[model samples]
Target: MGDLANAKNGLNIFLNPLYYGKINDNLKKQIVKVETTKDSAYFERIENEITDELNKRLSGVLEDYAEIKGHVSSFQSLHGTISLNKASSLDMVHGKWATHDDYIADWLSGLKDSIESGRPSMMQKIFKIQRIREYVLLFLERDFYRHYKVRTKDKPQENLWSIWFGSETLFWGLLISPRLIEDNWENKPGRIRKVEFGYWTIGHVLKTGLVDPENNTIYKFRDLNDFLIFYESILKRVSNSIYEKQIFAFYVDYIRKSQNPLLEPLLIPEFRYEGIKQKHKYRLDFTILNCHTGERIGFELSPQSTHMAISGIKSKTQTELNKDLALKWGREMQKRNEYFQQYGITIMTFTDDNLIDMKNCFKAMEYYLSKRKADRQSVDELIQDIISIK
Candidate 1:
């Protein structure tokens, strides 16, 4: 494996059998060889199967998972894979192997429950296992042939101890049968948090990657330090008002305190609007992407000095200045509404009054920082309001 470190914890995905549809012929030949030889040697089997030819085949199939280091975890080591294999294979003899149909039926039940619970991530996990079920059946079939005893004229009951292929199948089954994926999602650094497109507007905006407004180029940051370096560069070189800079200093402190491997608030400076480009289309001063929940919040630093300033006022009449002021105010409100409607961003403004107590202003936004939901009005309150009006 080239750049084996890049594959890292993602070797599980590379080893996923379903993704290698074209390798079915090669896999069938390996199964046949194992069956004829009746060899249960784990490491020997893997080393033999993972030949230069097989690796070439795997390269074509596993490019996506192998090359993408961000998709992998540092937690899963070679030792971990072997440990999982030993544990699962030892237990395989104690339980009856499920028929292919039964296995699929169980997966469908889990899929239904996941969907009803609104867990698309869990559904995806189930689907991955469900797709590779045929490979499991192939392994079972191979075992039946390999363990066949001439004296008994029957398949001898045996535990599967093959590390590479057996472990990968067991891993997929464990992921679906137990709540391993969900457990990792909540408590461990595993899958990169991916937002589905329909879930929120911010999903569509940052779907590709973060856009650097300074250069209008894509910037990929893997860690807090990467983001901080990019942010510091913008502050030193880009033109921002003193108030905005002060607010950003506070934001940096907040990000530092809240930063974690799983959940980090990305404060993108001057996040460009996804709406139609126009003179009125103002980039958000700061857009905080809550990676944990896929929620976006916009911080607008609207100090009266800059927001309400009328340029070339001395060159215009009183009526012209008033008209310009009205237009400017109109555009500001329109931009706020547009952001909310188009990007699902809760735009919070900090005027001079709000900036006077800037710490408290930022504090007020704590509620909208997570998964946002509309508070439902109670029937009792509705009835009371109706009676009071009469």
Candidate 2:
């Protein structure tokens, strides 16, 4: 984690995407395009200046979170990995006569054998477990396995958490899940979940935020900060219950606020953005027009993107529900039609279904809208006749 501090700014992306929607490629390009206008010298100077300041800020924040001073970080990529020490003998389980290492490897192998046997009974048991979390090769003794954990910078909690052995690992350009995200924050929740394309075993640490001065050398998924990093692709224990609920709540709030005509036409989203604040006057990833108030506000489309602003993660950063947000701006209203295409926005997300895009939403409440329009039309006609007489 070269810049674990780079995380402090956007670590909650797995939680709230409004935070990450800005730093995306499209937005970065837009920011570069907007700021670089005819002044390469000024732009480069600013970049250098920002980089210097960022180093300071990131270092400070990461330290505050739990990173020990003078500890060298082995995790480098944006999907940062912290290489830690692994000792087999010390990981013994009392009475069980099994070391943590042995137990883990055994578990992995048993799981593999179970899957490989093609037994229906095992599959049924696995179906239940799969619902809970994806099987990322249970380690039976020493045989190590690998998985691709996708997420922004905060935490590679979970997105496309799968083991890659063959050709899939070759191209490894961060394969985004070919699924509707955003309104679904199952794996990608709260930032800093690393996507490991290796035989990486995550270190489990206490949440007391205290770092062991002696074990500072272990850095791959190491626990320096109170923020826990897991190399396992899926966040099995807590994802469905906590992550999904929290992000979905945020999306629900967004929809609720959008529905309130206090603004005008609802600001429909074209895409999501991560870190737009640093670049624009208003940082937004989604665009929506309010039909009544006629205020087309820029929305930051995040299933639950929060406010850290760093960028550069391979897998976790690929399946952008926000599309970098640069694509949503400046389009004409007619574009909203896009072939009637059930025009709507995802107001909510979860582990399974993307809930309540505007199109479906409007259909559900169609009667109310129709009646409101009718009432307005009658009033307009009455006024027009009165004016005509005058």
Candidate 3:
């Protein structure tokens, strides 16, 4: 019974393929030991005990997998089916008829081999179960799904993506939040109240709507699509340079078409310092959060027009020109350094040359911006089992 308990530890290594290999090897070793033993009846009794426990555990796993399979099947018909080629390294035909037959053949073969060799043959079935289960969970737990879509009693029939953008008014209600006073200083008459205008997460914005106390406007958004339009409109209304417009536009369009739901689509524009008074209130052009890594990044488009422009009618000496040039350079570097020191944000500045090739400039940051899948962790018990056998 103690050996049986030790053997049954393999049951906990569900959905992990490498651990399944370890389990297969362990069972093989147990069979070898039983065959060589003088009093084989005792070892035979232990094998039977282990087999019964394994069967009971596998039965529970199968039942749970079946329930999840139904939800996943329904999800695929609405969105898109999981590619069978992704299931295994085996070359599967693109069509359903061919792939299904191939999969069944492989499953049966694996089972037969396991039975004949006194090893567990359920890895193939478990792998398939885990793949579809992971796919469904990814769809459900993704940032885009949580932020933009709502769980419904009845899911709408049409392609939800198409329907999302079909009408301007589609998801308006979800974004509506009550107007909040961003800044309320001492009630000194003649002092103008300032409302929040920059640097907000989509979740935060949805929870507490943007407020413009001066204009008496409260801004809300329904989905990521609506937020993009709002962001673009903000840039259009401001004095953003052509370089700023082009870079921002490309990033927005890229996220719109990409399937990676982990991307934070909107870059927070005109980011400002909060609850602090400074001699110079420096604000970032655009800021974004890396959802996968939880790193904050700042984008600055420094064209010659804005960054180097010096307006002075008085012509000064060589010393004056040097002083002014040094000051300008210092200011730019200070902004970058302060952001890094205070907020742990890395500022990636794009000059006129870099902005000219926006795609290439973005390529340098593609690693940080892209999706990062979670790494698989090894099971300690499974590792011990392998080490014991060796």
Candidate 4:
């Protein structure tokens, strides 16, 4: 009974619904239904069965309940710290925490500080779960298909052991769902050729006998370390753009935390201006509006890969033409800058190099805000300046 209790507690922490918030909404809806259902005998039975299997699996890997509780405690502490910080800060300022922008910069800043101070955060746990998920899916897809020939495409009965087991396990259900996988083929002149887009498929597992899609061309891993190396390489390739967006989100979060009624920051605001030729529209990455004075300051992030012509466009044949076009685009960007300056927009640009570190990113923004605060321009004067530019 004690062992069963420990197992239940451990599994709950490991597969908490909160961890799966970023997953598909459909999966979330299904999870809620399962959690809320009261009278379903099948659901209860399936839950108990999954619990028993997971307990048995984890007993082999985890040392004891202490380790599980440690992780759970860390997650709880991190969440509590963020909440406490927000509450305390809002109390100090005697202001309500507004939900208008979905900005929780103060909370995020607290979390980041905790993480940097050697406290555990969701990032570490997320990576651990991702590793476990990969291992489980690989084992199941390979073993189940090879031994029982239970392909998901066969519309396997919901009551079948394999289907029932997968559905009851949260991570398995999230990753192994039929809807999550897609197969693509290219129709060539003589024969159809398989063009890999790094998708998961049972066909690849069964036919090619490959354990992972990422290992198709590379040498197969004989040990855990080798598999981790392969996993990291694939993860890096897929997560670069995601990481860039996360950095942007963190910047927004920092701005939200520093929120003062006197100076409220707006994100990704659209500005309209008439060009010499036609009407032009531009979106600033972030804009700070001084509520007391009504002056606006804009900040733009220009990542080298996305914004700079030297790193962005890459075609051997079009290299010379692209350089010429890039110069033309540069001149247009200059004109936009001139227009913003004419209208008293006080635009500042930061490149990828400037945002390499989170601490540095916040510092740069803080410096800009300070400078803007010191400016003597009035809101009415700025408005008149904008009118004159128009």
lDDT to native, each model? 0.42, 0.26, 0.43, 0.35
* lDDT-sorted candidate list, best first: 3, 1, 4, 2
Q: Can you rank all candidates by TM-score, best first?
A: 3, 1, 4, 2
Please, what are the lDDT tens digits per residue for candidate 4 over residues 115-230? 45765443323213322322222222222222221111122112111110001111011012222124311112311122111012221212222212222121344543343343
Model 2 regions lying over 4 Å from their true place = 1-248, 253-283, 291-294, 300-390
Q: What's the residue-level lDDT of 193 in candidate 2?
A: 38
Q: Model 1's lDDT to the true fold?
A: 0.42
The per-residue C-alpha lDDT of model 4 at residue 191 equals 14
Question: lDDT tens digits, residues 77-133, model 3?
Answer: 322322332343222332111112223333333333444465532332333343333
Instruction: Give candidate 3 regions above 4 Å deviation.
Output: 1-209, 213-217, 260-265, 275-280, 309-318, 364-367, 371-390
State residue 371's C-alpha deviation in candidate 4, in Å: 5.8
Ranked by TM-score, the better of candidates 1 and 3 is 3
Q: Candidate 2: worst 10 consecutive residues by lDDT?
A: 164-173
CA RMSD of all predictions: 24.0, 31.2, 19.3, 25.4
Give me the candidate number with maximum TM-score.
3
How far does residue 145 in candidate 4 sit from its true spot (Å)?
82
Where is model 1 more than 4 Å wrong at Cα?
A: 1-223, 235-237, 259-262, 274-280, 291-295, 311-321, 365-367, 370-390
lDDT of 1 by residue, 91-209 (tens): 33332222222222233333344445654331122122312222322332333333333211211111100000111111100010111242231112321121222211223223333
Candidates 1 and 4, the one with greater TM-score: 1
Q: Where does the lowest 10-residue lDDT sum fall in candidate 4?
A: 165-174
Residue-level error in angstroms, candidate 1, position 241 = 1.4
